[model samples]
Target: MVTLTPLEAELLAVAGSVPDPELPVLTLQELGVLRAVHVRDTDSVEVELTPTYTGCPAVEAMSTDIERALRDHGVREVTVRTVLIPAWSTDDISAEGRRKLREFGIAPPRAQRTAGPVGITLGPTRTAGQDPEPVRCPNCGSADTELLSRFSSTACKALRRCLDCREPFDHFKEL
Candidate 1:
């Protein structure tokens, strides 16, 4: 049996607490960014991640957060590895992550058939032919919404305003 030191275990726990810089409601794990963690024989910590979006600028901050969290837990050496294969998706977000996003006032992604592109789904009708509907407001659960901007505070989301509640909110746009 492999033995794990208390410090190593503690480091692992703290590493998971680091939240996504863009989506603060979700942790790296909940965002499905954290792929794995291992405590090396040399007492160094290894962290693997798949970026939520390719060319995401938040990755640098995420790596820094991981290193800081591990360092605080007494890990002197830390390696943050980025993996790209089997790309990350909104589907990868956990159920709890969806809940967290809702609580944070950002609508979670809508679920659809897994037939086509990452966010596209082909039904009997072609998705390309229809204009995408407005995403519901997470705060008030209203479908009466309008897109204020294609890009929100982050590139992954869009700025939307609800007609019923008259609230401006961010919606995680379908890719």
Candidate 2:
């Protein structure tokens, strides 16, 4: 096994310490945004990440946090790079991250289901009485919420209103 120098080790540890700007309770690593960390020449550190969604405003804040963390960890030069290919999916969310989201009153993503591999087939009919299960209210835990909007404060979530509690909450959209 290759041993990282003190500087490299420090960089890695500090980089993981940086929290997600939007969801402050969870660190970047927990959000699965901190993809890779590399240190070269003992002074420069490069970190790669992908945004939760396209054109997410939090990207700037994430980059700033990364730079700050590396600087504090003794990296004289830091480079924050974002990669878009392959994009991001809810499946990338860590187990700890889901717990944090749930504690924050946001439902985490559910397991993916498809009609078939490589494609989703629409059945000829979904009986009127067989509607998909309603999302549980984040505030009241009642399964009587209605989707208010497809988009919310973030692209990855939807705005929903609980019919039972009359409270609005963000539901992490299933990707």
Candidate 3:
């Protein structure tokens, strides 16, 4: 089993508890944004964060919150780094995060379909061989939903209306 130093463990505990500025209902750990925490030999903490999307404006706020959290926990030095090499996907959202999203009236992203090296295409016009998955309604747990708009309050979500419940909600779009 892997072992953690006292400082590393403390840093993780503090940083993981930091809540996402955009979605306050979930912690950074729940959103899978708090990727890793390291205790450097210089007696500083290094945190790795992955944004839900490339252009997410809340990343800065998140970083600030993380730093503040560490500082409050008696950590003198802290560094927050954003990593995009592997990129962040809707799948990164934890199961608890999904439950929170649904409870907040936002439909979570659907499971991605298996594809080859090229990956699946998404647009107004579906590829001849690609079949779009149905978007479920978070409010009533119904599959009878229709797209209202391609974009919602954020780029990562789409506006959708549930025909069964006649409720409009945001659908966390699959990355």
Candidate 4:
């Protein structure tokens, strides 16, 4: 791991504390978007951020928020850079972030899907050949759910309903 200077660490804490625009329940750090903080000088700093996916509009808002946060913390020259070389994944989310998402009535994203031996079902549906990973309901803890829409309030989330609780929720889709 790269060692952060004392000021960089402090500034990172401030930048990471900014709440996500789409999911207010999660902070930028919790969302795993705030990557690093580079202290250029006492008053200048640079931040690295990754988006949930390519073409996500939230990156602009996130950058603005990060700049504002750093400014409030006595930073004068703040630059929030968007980095996509290492794509953001749902697995980057912290355990606390997942729990918070569930508490906020949104199902947290699952881990990366494995390539070998996927569960398959013989059915008439388009996905009948191989069953996609089950997305459990955050409200009822039941895997019996159906996708209502490919997109929800946010592009990163999908709309779903729990078969047991009958409550609709947004699932933070895996990247």
Specify the highest-lDDT model's number.
Answer: 4
lDDT (Cα) of model 4: 0.84
Q: Relative to the true structure, how large is the alpha-carbon lDDT of every model?
A: 0.77, 0.76, 0.80, 0.84
**1-175 in candidate 1: lDDT tens per residue?**
3465676556656877899887787887777777677787566888887887787899999999999988887778999999987777777778898899989999887665473476434432211224464467788887777767768887788787887898988877665
- TM-score against native, each model: 0.78, 0.80, 0.85, 0.87
- Shift in Å, residue 3, candidate 3: 5.8
* Candidate 2 whole-model C-alpha lDDT, 0 to 1: 0.76
Q: Sort the predicted structures by TM-score, highest score first.
A: 4, 3, 2, 1
TM for candidate 1 is 0.78
The C-alpha stretches of model 2 lying farther than 4 A from their native spots are: 1-10, 114-134
lDDT of 2 by residue, 59-137 (tens): 9999998999888766789899998856677777889988888789996765556422223345322212233645676
Report the Cα lDDT for residue 30, model 2.
Answer: 83
Residue 70, model 4, lDDT = 88
Clashing pairs in 3: none
Error of 1 at 48 (Å): 0.8
Worst 10-residue lDDT window, candidate 3:
123-132
Candidate ordering by lDDT (highest first):
4, 3, 1, 2
Q: What is the model-wide C-alpha lDDT for candidate 3?
A: 0.80
